[model samples]
Target: MGVQVWTWILVGITFAIYFGIAIWARAGSTKDFYVAGGGVSPLANGLATAADWMSAASFISMAGIISFSGYDGSVYLMGWTGGYVLLALLLAPYLRKFGKFTVPDFIGDRYYSNTARTVAVICALIVSFTYVAGQMRGVGIVFSQFLQVDITLGVIIGMAVVLVFAFLGGMKGITYTQVAQYCVLIFAFMVPAIFISFQMTGSPIPQIGMGGKVEDGAYLLDKLDQLHTQLGFKAYTSGSKSTWDVFAITLALMVGTAGLPHVIVRFFTVPKVKDARKSAGLALLFIAILYTTAPAIAVFSRTNLIETVSNTAYKNMPQWFRNWENTGLIAWTDKNNDGKIQYVNGAALEGKTPMFLSERGEHGQRVISNSSTGPNELYVDRDIMVLANPEIAKLPDWVIALVAAGGLAAALSTAAGLLLVISTSVSHDLIKKQLRPDISDKAELKIARISIVVAIIVAGIFGIYPPGFVAAVVALAFGLAAASFFPAIILGIFDKRMNKEGAVAGMVVGTVLMLFYMVRFKTGLVGVLDPLPESEWWFGTSPEGFGTVAMLVNVVIAVVISRVTPAPPASVQDIVENIRIPSGAGQASTH
Candidate 1:
């Protein structure tokens, strides 16, 4: 079958399943809408959480990053997975015992102040919206490739589909849909890895295949290292990042992962505090399946890509190369006019353009003098690696279609999860809790729906325009969460004397410092000053790793302020004690 027909059939089937799940699991009460009535089994909730947590970045882009960055990219794998351990041990069970509907709900009640809650809500909105933009962009990429539409139109279609599920079922519908998504995405991710592994290393297991000897009796890693050295790239097994930066980035990612409101809220949907802990454990296992295999897939795809394209004639370039080139992600200008593509490490050579657009001359031949320099000629968007793996390996058309469906599932599930948090924070926390405390559940639910619509529209706009800020916002979201929310939430649970004043100061200071660094160094939002480079950074920290410093600052500031201030009220202390024990902890109440 053709790519188009296969894609439509597979994607159509998945969409039908999602819509069916939405209809069958529709929410009636605000409780159902927010926490699925707190009746979900641990296993089911774990699967749903895995789907909710693994966004398009995890599914489509992670391995490609590992492929290119080599050992440096291991930061993502270690950081993301390590955070789950913290969540399961320190936060999930206690939060489930607190029995609140949202993260801000816990913050507000714990501090006995609406101001603290409002600050938390602001942080949640910032993180969730920033994260959602990436998901929407992933959705657009998948749709543009599969449906043969413009990226803008694809984003619109993705927005509409998300609206249907989020608008109809809220959390109740979203949870079940995510369960289905987990199944589809995992299947899509694994099949190609297994196939490619067997083809290359004679091992059915991808992890072993990555380290196993190939047909030439050489270890895959050894071969990759040799190839990288010959091509002027860093060794595949060695990294160039400083040790402190890696440590800082990994810690930031771990804390940020645990702190993200959308992820923490998943624990609330289960029946008991114990179940919440079990769900986190199970979710980690489900996520690990992909995490461990990603590096293997990276090795396979990187090797294949290099051997296939490097020093090959342009006329002999594979169909996948041309297909991606049409997307403007991959371009070659034949810098030497030899009609051959030279894929090299452009960063190794200063003031050299790797890829450029060649202007046509009178004879319609490529003219190098008129070429325009931008991104490297050999550039490849990391997101395309997973999506194009099956095609590049010449797998069946159905397999390619299945990969497309899986990518969409990953993006949509996480996007819907984020949109839910953004909506609930507004309707439940901001409007109902603070503004209209006496609002009816019916009215609150209406407001929630309206909030979702607005959130989706805004997310779509960010995806369509995709500013430079939007491109790096996922890192920003993680850093912001690490700085602003993680310490407060952690301290609030463990420390009875953590006053509202201290928590608020920590959050505000942490958020402000993190944003200042990102805007000045990363975003260039303030043009008055040039951003500092790595050598000039404080403690040699990159903006990506600055969150660790910000987090530590928040913790120290909070401790100092709390010591000088009066302790929390006795009732608040009692609530903290009650949550820790979890003896009589009940289901999260809608009220």
Candidate 2:
């Protein structure tokens, strides 16, 4: 069968499995909805956690960014991996011990204030929404390209799929569903990687093949570096970002991962503190399998793309190239009217992607309506690299279909998790806790379902019209999480003297500061004014790294305010003390 037929078959089967799990394991009560009835095995939770953590960003965009940016993209690998370690060691166990299934619930009870809970809920909404946009966009990218539909239509389809399972089973459904997703996504990611690795180098293992020689017996990196210098681009192993920016982005992603409410809540699904710790460790192992392979895949895809397209006749390009071109992910402007594609480094369009013309050019390639000032004539969206890698290497139809299925699994799994967070925050944190403390579990569950549905719609909108692509948008979400929740959660746990006033003030300031910078610089829309130039960056920090500054400011503001204000009540102080007891995260009397 062809790629499209195989795509429908694989995507249909996996999605059917997800829907089946949702029906079979549907949530029975608030406990089931919130934390899978807190009975999940460590291993199961670990797999689910791995699936949840590795969103479309990890499966799709991370390597794509690395393929394009080269060594500069290593920050994502280091920061995200380091951040998981940070979460496992610094945050996850204690949060699990505290026994509030949600971050807002923890803050609300820990700080002894609904106001603080409300703030945390708002922050969670912002971060999760921002993050989910990337996941949904990833789904759209996979669907639009593989299924041959418009990206907008693709996002809508994804929204419906997520709503089915997420609405039916909540976290109970999402957990097991993620385990299946993890298997699909991981296998899909590794198979082609192995194939292309062996095809290029003698080694079948991608990690080893990355360091091995090409057919010419030249080191693979050496060949890639040679190709890069032949073009107008920097060498593949070089870094162009300032050291400060790199440090900031890495810090933001790391702490942001630690503070992400969706990831933290996974720890709550387990039965005991020991189970949480065990799951964290297992999750790291599972995560490393893909994380370690990403750089190799990046290198392979980058090298393949340059060699395949550079100076090649547009008419002679392969079927995969034309397929991607039809999706508008790639284009040719035919600068100087050359019949060959010029894949040299530079912008091929004024904007992020090519605006394609309705008609084809002289070489019968997709004509871009927009043109660039530079010499480069081709426009290839980086997000397409991982998806197109298998096709570029001429892998079988089944492998490409599996990749599409895996992309969906990765995207939908995380989308379900994030939508659940949005629902839990609204129904449990905002409505049940604040608006109607007397609301019944049935009503809250109903509300949570409604919240998930509504959240899915909003996510679809963001996917249809994103501020940026997957990694960039996800990084901003991390920045928001780091700035707002990291200090509040860490301080609330460690600082017995920390009060509600300080926590609330810190969260608000940090979130607002990060938002201001992101709007002014990243998104470029603050009350209709132009985005500030790079020269106006705060102390030369990019928006992605600015979260570290916001997080520090949050810590300082939280500390200074807590010193001047009255200390937390004796009962609250005692809760903090009990959480620190290394023996185990005991039952939360607060819960």
Candidate 3:
């Protein structure tokens, strides 16, 4: 079968499995919706957690970012992997021991104030919505490139699929379905990597193949370094970012992972503190499988892209080039009228992405109105690198189709998790806990389902008109989580003296500050205006790194306010003490 046919078959089969799981495990009560009745075994939770953690950013965009950024991209690998460790070690078990359904649940009950809970809820919404935008956009990219749909139509289809599962199964359905998704996604990612590895380096293992020699008897890295410098780009293994900026971005991603409400709530599904710890360990192992392979994939894909397209004639370009051009993710213009693609180290267009003209050139290549005056005439969106790699390498139709399915799985799994967080925050945190304390379980469940519908609509809009690349947008979400939730959650648990006033003040200021930086710099108000240049970066730190500064500011404000204000009540202090105690953790009051 052809690539599209195989894509339809694989995607159809995988999606069917997800839908079946959603119906089979559909939530019957508020408990099932919130945390799968808090009876999930550690192994199941581990697979679900791994699936939840490795989103579209990890599966679709992480390697893509590395492909473009080279050594500067190592920060993503270090920061994300390290952050999971920080969260698993410092937060997950304690949060699970507290027996709360969500992060806001813990904050509200612990801080002894609905106001503080309200702040956490708002922060969670901002973070989850921002993160889910990337997932939905990933879905759109896969559909546009592989399934040959318009990006808008693709996002709408993605929204419908997510809403069905999230509305039906809630956490119960999401968890079990994610296990199946993890299997599909990992297999999809690895098969391509292994094939490309053996094709180039005669090794089946991508990690080793990255370091091994090619047919020319030269090491892969050495050949890539030669290719990079020859093309006016920096050495592939050398770093270009300032040391402090790298540190700040890394720290931001690390803490952001720890504070993400969707990821943290995974622990709440487990029955005991020990189960949370066990799942955390198991999740780390599973996540490493992809994380470790990402850098190698980045190297292989980057090498192949440059060798295949650089200085290649438009007419002679591979079939994959024209296919991607139809999606507008990759474009070329006959700059200098040379009829050749110049994939050098400069922007190919005046804007971030290409603006394709309605007309075709003499050589039948799509014309781009936004072509720049620079020597480079090729525009390739970074998000397409991973999806296009298998095709670029001339892999089998089944392999390419599998990648499309995997990208969708990676995206949908995380989208379902994030939408669930958004819904539960509104229903469980705002409605049940704060608004209508007497609301029955049935009504709360219905409200939760409704909330998912609304949140997915908003998320679909963001996906349709995204502010940045998948990983870049996701990085901003991490920064927001770091600035807003990290300090409050950490101090609330560790500093029993921390009071509502302190946590509330810290959350408000940190979130606002992070928002200010992101708006001024990263998003440009969803294209209402142009973003400020890198020259205007604050203290040489990019928006992704500003979260570290904001987080520090939050810590200072929280600590200072806590010291001046009255200590948390004796009962609140004791609740903290009991949660930290290992022996009684399983028996602690969930209220």
lDDT tens digits, residues 439-516, model 2?
999999999999998999999999999988899999999999999999999998889999999999999999999999
How does candidate 2 score on lDDT?
A: 0.94
TM-score of each: 0.94, 0.98, 0.98
For model 1, state the Cα shift of residue 55 in Å. 0.7
lDDT of 1 by residue, 484-542 (tens): 99999999999988999999999999989998888777666444766665576888887
- With candidate 3 superimposed using the best TM-score fit, by how many Å does residue 506's alpha carbon deviate from the native? 0.6
Which stretches of candidate 3 lie above 4 Å from their native place? 526-528, 584-591
**Regions of model 1 farther than 4 Å from truth:** 347-376, 467-472, 526-532, 582-591
Query: Clash pairs of candidate 1?
Result: 354-377, 355-376, 355-377
Q: Rate the local accuracy (lDDT) of all candidates.
A: 0.86, 0.94, 0.94
- The alpha-carbon lDDT assigned to residue 333 of candidate 1 equals 60
